[model samples]
Target: MIRRIFPYPVLSVGFFATWLLFNQSVTPGQLILATFFGVTSPWLLVRLDAPPFRMRRPLMILRVLWTFAKDIAQSNLRVAKTIIASPHPPPSGFVRIVLEMRSPYGLAALACIVTGAPGTAWISYDPVDNVVVLHILDLMAEDDWAASIKTRYEKPLMEIFE
Candidate 1:
């Protein structure tokens, strides 16, 4: 009985919370509408085929989040300094990293992390080769950047998702 009503309970709760936060009201009508949409959207979305997701180590997720946040802040500072100090702009280049992570979800999360931080953008990823091409604003050491991504972010994500 409960399963039928809440096919995706987590998604339903997220939707309801997001609606309330966006609307910024707790009126009867608002609650009714949020509840209706929250319950319905998940049911509709469940039809789509999604990859199997399982967190092997839940505690590692927090570590990944913290590392990502720190990297973003550091990257912002580095980029800002480069922009302010450099009269002749540093040469920007693309670095192709050979990745060992095979999980689609893990790869997607890595894409977000790499692209979200300043000065770096995800150019393209070759799933067949398991290689990610990244465009960096200030390309100093190609090997160092690749190592940093693998050690700082990719490794943690692998632990959590794979």
Candidate 2:
């Protein structure tokens, strides 16, 4: 059945195409190896028993991507300035964010987004409390940082994934 053989059709085709591109030739050996990988990856994924994610408001994903890109660019500049100036000691501290998203996939995406930002690093997450701890290189105001994250990242993710 299609469901069992290729639970993730997009992933399978991408892997197969990447393998062919990497090999740079369509030899029998390459074909066999690519087929093996494509088949095995789907099989392994099927065993994981992940729920089918219903992505509501798919355009929100684009919004999230754009926001992340802008934040990364701005954060890179801010971090660079902090490193070069060395005028004052860096204001680094940890802050705990209470997350409303309970889905594992959503939480993982949130963690990636927070950590990908230059000034912040995800420390630990407590599932029971739905809280995430993050260390920020420049902690000017906890409320401002929390509000920015909730508004910029979490709200969009909640729309898309939750």
Candidate 3:
């Protein structure tokens, strides 16, 4: 009986907590709505046949967060210098990176990390090829970008989510 109601317990709690946070209230009506969504969304989502999420090494999340913060800070300064201080337009191009990690959650995290940094955008990911395409403002550093992404980002994410 409990299983039928809370199909995904963690997801249910997340949905509930997120709703309450967005509303910033614990009033009766708000609680009702939060409860309704908390129970229903995950119940309906079970149809998607998504892979189960299992974090093998939860402590690695701190490393990923630290790396993301540092990269964002450095990228911001570099992009600003190129745009505001340079005389010439910085070279920009797309580069393809072969990815070994297949977890959807890890891929999503990777997308956030790449796109969150200044002067770089996620172009696309091809599942069949297991490759990710990224457009970077500094094309001359394409090789460095590819290697940095693999080691600085993907490696940590793979350990965290896969």
lDDT of each: 0.92, 0.88, 0.92
- Cα deviation in Å at residue 145, candidate 3? 1.2
User: In candidate 1, which residue pairs clash?
Assistant: none
TM-score per prediction, in order, is 0.84, 0.85, 0.84
Question: Can you write out model 3's per-residue Cα lDDT over 88-122, one digit (the tens) per residue?
Answer: 99889999999999999999999998999999999
Runs with alpha carbons beyond 4 Å of true place in candidate 1: 27-29
Top candidate (TM-score):
2
- Backbone clash pairs for candidate 3 read none
Model 3 weakest lDDT span, ten residues long:
138-147
Show how many residue pairs clash in every candidate, following the order shown. Answer: 0, 0, 0
Q: How well does model 2 score by local distance difference test?
A: 0.88
Q: Can you tell me which runs of candidate 2 are displaced by over 4 Å?
A: 20-28
